[model samples]
Target: MGIHIIKMPDIGEGIAEVELVEWHVQPGDTVVEDQVLADVMTDKATVQVPSPVDGKVQALGGKVGEVMAVGSELIRLEVDGPGNAAAGAKQKRPVERTETAAQAEDATAPAPVQERGADAHVATPGPAQVPIKGQAGQVQPAQSQPQVQPAAGAGHAAARPAGEKPLASPAVRKRAWDLGIELQYVPGTGGGGQITHNDLDSYLARGAMGSAAAGRAAGYAPRDDEQAVSVIGLRRKIAEKMQESKRRIPHFTYVEEVDVTELDALRARLNAQWGAERGKLTILPLLARAMVLALRDFPQINARYDDEAGVVTRYGAVHLGIAAQTESGLMVPVLRHAETLDLWACAAEIARLADAARAGRAAREELSGSTITLTSLGALGGVVSTPVINHPEVAIVGVNRMVERPVILGGAVVARKMMNLSSSFDHRVVDGMHAAEFIQTIRGYLECPAMLFVE
Candidate 1:
């Protein structure tokens, strides 16, 4: 049998880097071309990396749950004879660590242990441990570990041997410091019993992670130079897109107040009867319906610029992207054909999309192809914030808090239902004047519910 090394396959997206989430087949296991070998995590989805050559699995790189860059070696195979590349026997397999480089990138990383906050000599956690093939490692849960107390709180720290090193990561050490937990007090369960994030989490959950830290390390002082931190996750993505929108698109913002008292009453009436289904009714559906109708009157917001084709693409139907606030990041899932759906249908779709986003189950298709977007911060008691336009299709609307306020009607001060509608459009295609008109168009529907019935 000739040795055939099976490098990582290009998944056709040409995108570099995928996270190694799981390994299905182990080395020495027989696999066929096209058999599923491992599952990889991309930015948008988790895809399975299949075998390209038929044979026995030879060498495998990296451990499961580690994020590996694309073009990196995933697995190697030993083929009996070269045959089909597209077809193979389906191979299902076991879980274990494969071979690796003798030296990892984080080699020499000292594990942090608290020896009365003395000199620490801990190696980097298991993720960056001795690299070897078929290494038998255990995922020792932190729960079994003793609570680690830090210098600030390690008043009774057990002395460590001069040559013995503690096991903990920099981040874990930082966390222990913050909580006054002395790592010296906490026994690690990592390979050679090292401290991991999970161990720290376990310690914290048990309320024994840390106590009073002695204080800041002696001779520690802040420097004049300040570190500028970049946002991460949802905030980072949001800031990048917002900055790009402001720089690329000439933005036009429009603000108007919608009198939603009648709509509110209708919602309350329906919710009372809906009970379980009534839980589905939110202000979002009504707002979506209003926006859909407004788009019908002012079609510019639903249009995209085709710079190369020299023709603007004005959409005949609305594909509304609902912005959901999730823990990891902001996800905007599109609801295609928003105009054709009724208010109830819109509410159901919004709930489904939001749930999918929250659960991290949002499909790639659910996130793309949005003609326009709706953002709701009303739940946070916010009012009248300008929303940056989501580019390409240049418009996004924001819903503010709903509250009762006195209004002057024909010189008569009376209470009127009030909610702010703030929308920003692309000045390139949707001019400021037209944008304001569009907001007013939505106001027209929100104020007069009869228009919805007629349309």
Candidate 2:
């Protein structure tokens, strides 16, 4: 048998360290070539580490949630012939171990114990035979005691005999007291009718912990369960990004309601005329068109801010980012050059990007380089929202749920489709008046509908 060592490879973009997100193999498990050994996370991207040679896993390099540096040992395997451990010994030298690590290693090492036969001594649910800590911090097994079998018909815990004194150990008595169980009502399964821990467990497991609790409604039963989930991988990156955006930038939000009855009618007309030849249209593509034309007048809203360099770069081409909710989390996939595509083309590209993002197939390039962002919650969109600007970007526009309500027009009540635009901008770069004006310009294109087609 030969030893093979695999080191963490450098994923590009000058990343020096990556967090170990998941492991596909454990020690003693045989793995084949090209099999994924582990999953590591760098920034928001996840990369899989594959085994180059078939081997049995000897040891894992790190635990999940550990941030390990590039070139660190990832795994050790046992292969058939001479392995790379000997050839690359100098290049992949073992890391220096600290005193704490040595002690931890020794503490987890299994101690030698003799195996017992089935007919020998059987372990009971009591303090006896349980391991206890000695004065030297060493574990010592408690002395064994005599064992007794429960009655053949002891499936249900029967009440003790009327005049016979109930028998039990001090430990069992204390546990019964804690559970508010009376010893006289419990049946003993030990010698001389002594109640054992197993009897108490059986009573609880049979849904009869106590008469009063059993009679209570199941919906109101007391529960003592909890779960702890570790925040790692893409979730951690999102948390960090949101925190950075909130901490560094001063955000100001503006909201405006628009009458979209004419816009919806226009969309229906176009979809009806071209539904067979071209793709159907959604409000998103029309909104994208409105934003594109509006940006021509309000160029300041479509820009990125470099706080460290104290520079703001505005782009002529609108690379719009559409926020998408995926199975994993929130992701923003960019639609390059939204100003060039018509309504149908824009809708097709938006759907394609959204599908790619949801399926976890969005490329890194497709996820970045957006001048501004647009976010919508579809039918779940509520009255209004205060959306956070994507970090380094000046603004983000949000769409709310559209509803038809009564409105007074021409001194008469009429129903109109209305929606609200909730948008936020960096207060350092954009003034309140300009922010409101930008949304008003987009609202103009949307409310009029015909203006979107004009030059």
lDDT of each: 0.66, 0.77
Q: TM-score of each candidate?
A: 0.61, 0.74
After superposition, the stretches of candidate 2 with alpha carbons farther than 4 Å from their true spots are 87-215
Q: Roughly what TM-score does model 1 have, to 2 decimal places? A: 0.61
Residue lDDT tens for model 1, 1-455 = 56565555565567677666567887679997789898676645556778777788765676664556666667667777653332343322322344322132233344333343232232322222321112122222121122232434233444344334566677777666545455555668778788777766665565552332334342351112111222433444466677876877777677788888888887777788884764658878887888888888777778876544666688988999898888756778899999888878888899999999888688777887889999987667466788876666778998888988999889999888889888888776777788888888788878876677685
Error of 1 at 283 (Å): 1.2
Model 2 lDDT per residue over 1-455, tens place = 78899999988889999998777876778999999999898774678999999999877787676789999999888899998776435433332223334553443222111123311221222223433332212233445423222323334543744434457776676565546444555677899778899988877676554456444453443322122345676667778888999998899999999999999999899989997789899999999999999999989989999999999999999999999998667888999999999999999999999999888778777888999999999888899999989989999999999999999889999999999999999999989999999999999999999999999
Q: Please give the lDDT score at residue 195 for candidate 2.
A: 84
> Superposing all C-alpha atoms, what RMSD in Å does each candidate have to the true structure?
9.9, 11.0
Model 1 has an lDDT value of 0.66
After superposition, which runs of candidate 1 have C-alpha atoms over 4 Å from their true positions? 1-74, 77-244, 275-279, 308-310, 406-417
